[model samples]
Target: MCDECNQYFAKKIEKRVLEMPYFRDVRHRNFIESKKRRIPVSKGIIGGAVDLKKRKDFGTEVIVNSPDIFQKILNGEVKHMIIPVNDQPIEDNKLISRFIAKIAIESAAQTFSSKKGWNNFIINTPEFKELRYYARFGDKLDMWNYSQRRIYNETDRFLNPKVSDGPYEVLHEQNLVFLRDRELYFVLVLFGIEYVISITNPKIDGYKSWLIENNNKCPIIEKNERDTIKGERYF
Candidate 1:
């Protein structure tokens, strides 16, 4: 499912919770429960500090308060975990906590433009510390997707320019990168984050050879090349 689907379903559950009068009654309730009942297993408290920069481009890094939550994910308890790709340290700033809470609120609330708006909201939050060096690996993956889409659409346009095919008309291949769980376990243990391949489909000229050639080029980054003992280049 896409990001929107994830947000929409989260919002539906949040709305149902808010409809209860007991929610306000337990305003000061502890992290996971309310006056009405215990919070479900699917939900947990997540807090974090994130920094974003758009020097000549955009990059974001977040250090969350809940590394244990990530451990739970690694253990197969959390399914749909969207942890930040960067492994920065948590700032000793409390004011920034509120900004993080707001983003969590928006993400859970599933409001429109919440992602972009929350980025701005966090940057302006008062206790905002010095701008840490930003991470662009995620952005690099995003750029690859955009580049693939551009090639896909331009080909489509060349083939049929009379009408617009809309966004979904472009075909995207599902690319998967295999990783050793043990290797990731160690990396996450140390850095709290692990780099992953940003897979893409390369549209080449011709049919059978095109498929074979692109399949060969499918993994822009190779496996086992980034283990901690190694220099560890990103995908």
Candidate 2:
């Protein structure tokens, strides 16, 4: 992307996504620090919420959001403050779709860099026109739909026998999968929440169909090329 477009994405799309209630909390849980190396705080209020911060020098610190709430707690008048957990199943579809589109196209460009002429093909292809326009310009479409689901808990650990640490957390994971319909979908997992987007078009029915056919299997797991219909994009 050009400098101007990069700045636009950084300020408008990426920042908003990072500070989103769910993503921010996930970042906090996975210790995914920002470019400035500061972890975010949660702001989800679905079940009410509290403010707290982790301290390297000490224990968890309760960063009060409201003086009134703090005073109430001090006076023993507070009942409870539920720390934010679990956002709405979906939020900010348009912004997120653009974000996904931006990353998808970028990833494809990078993936195709050594393939000779593929990067130019990606730039010129009409199949990605909507995604490119929407991601960079932000006015091509009102909203683009994607599929989101929690395949695991935010803090869940996976065991890897080869690793000395034993069970370890997955901060994030991503991959591309080709479906039988010849559509490519980008799957990204952040703190165990998986977000999938169809790159050839705005719809995600291809991914949904894949799940239904596979008995609701998580798409992030590597699949044999035979598992995909003539798969070449599963790398």
Candidate 3:
């Protein structure tokens, strides 16, 4: 990577990290602090499923607003759930939701694996392949859109270069691809839970236990309030 390319990638990463909803959140800051001090932080997992029913209550589990679920996840609510996809039905909504969820999970796993220095963590697993299939192919098993194709191509080029030339450019393109895919995955997951599923509530205790068991492998952050900047919450 040339100096200019390295600088560009660094800037892009910094900008994206700053743009994250949790960027200035207290809990996230604390997590970073704890990591720096070599203190162990308890990790939790946040997952979503499609539910089609609308109920008055969610029992002991608090019902978080659907739009705020992602923020809640960022805040570290290790176990969170969103209700049915939406008020109206759409064709193949269930299948779409499942596909989006898979993509989000896979992308998250990839991010974590890269950060934790695990090159082969979930990327090469059967589960990963299954999820990738869903992401790469829609309900009809057709190819993904051009954006997705571009991401895949960029990823390939970044990971395997024919020669050592344009290293920085390849790396930059890879990061851009990741950012685009991550955004798309989140959008799909949110849409799926908002409209398609039939369940009314989530099993919090079960999710927590699962998180505890998988903490070593997948650490989760705790939820915190989003910081206000100039009277507007970072979305």
Candidate 4:
């Protein structure tokens, strides 16, 4: 793997082949850097969703490699190759689909709850409906309960119908390419145990110019920048 690509993965992973009788070794392989190229494996299996924030020091998403690729690794048959996504590493890291998926997983887990007492706390609105083709796997469910929300303190703040948080604010521009029109300029808040929100129609044009003028920074204005649209662009 190139140093740049390696910078985005786990600093170390414990890997093993399913068929191997007695081998447990650290896996080393390059990621498919370019989204344009055809993914070589046709029958890959979903591994699991990971929290990049927990592993932020590593500088990349923590998705497990596909099972098909894992099998090849077990047999020592996998090969390394470099596929360029872009010249700028900043954009490349920002554009990663895994990170977006991670956000969706975290959001879904935080907002969707089945607890009877917290029925009033639910935010059932759907965003980015078209990107559902990519589903999460493993024990970490894509939905969450009120109890879990308290555990993570990941809830939206500012819950009112008129005022709203925008999606571009949540996903950021580098992460906005996969979203549907209605999903843009929408926002959700994760505060303490309570998730707060306000419903607003999507506004791509207004936010686009706003983001560009502000260098596509955070959609939410910060306290220091409260007076200026140019304040340190919320991230």
Which candidate should be chosen as best, given TM-score against the real structure?
2
**Candidate 3: global Cα-lDDT?**
0.31
Q: Candidate 3, residues 2-121: lDDT per residue as tens digits?
A: 476346434543333333332222222223333234212222224542222222242223333455655766777645443221112233433334433344544456556656645464
Q: Estimate each model's TM-score.
A: 0.15, 0.83, 0.24, 0.25
The digit string of per-residue lDDT tens for model 1 on 1-235 reads: 2486446434543444333333221221212343444342122223322222112122322233467755664577755523232112233212222222222333323432457675554345432211110111111222211111111111121122333432222222222222222110000011112112111121112222432655533232234322222222211
Tell me the deviation in Å of residue 65 in model 4. Answer: 27
Assess each prediction's global lDDT (C-alpha) against the native.
0.27, 0.70, 0.31, 0.27
> Which ten contiguous residues of candidate 2 have the minimum total lDDT?
226-235
> What C-alpha lDDT does candidate 2 achieve relative to the native structure?
0.70
Q: How accurate locally is residue 167 in candidate 2, as Cα lDDT from 0 to 100?
A: 58
Candidate 2 lDDT, tens digit per residue, 1-235? Answer: 7999999999999999777776776566556678987877654221234565656553556666766766777887766655645543355477788888888888878778889798679878887776788788765556767888866666556654554345565667887778757888888877556888888777777788888999887766744312211212101
Q: How accurate locally is residue 73 in candidate 1, as Cα lDDT from 0 to 100?
A: 49
Task: Rank the candidate models, highest lDDT first.
Answer: 2, 3, 4, 1
In candidate 1, the residue pairs with backbone N, CA or C atoms under 3 Å apart (3 or more residues apart, or in different chains) clash, namely none
Report the Cα lDDT for residue 208, model 3. 32
The number of clashing residue pairs in each candidate reads 0, 0, 22, 15
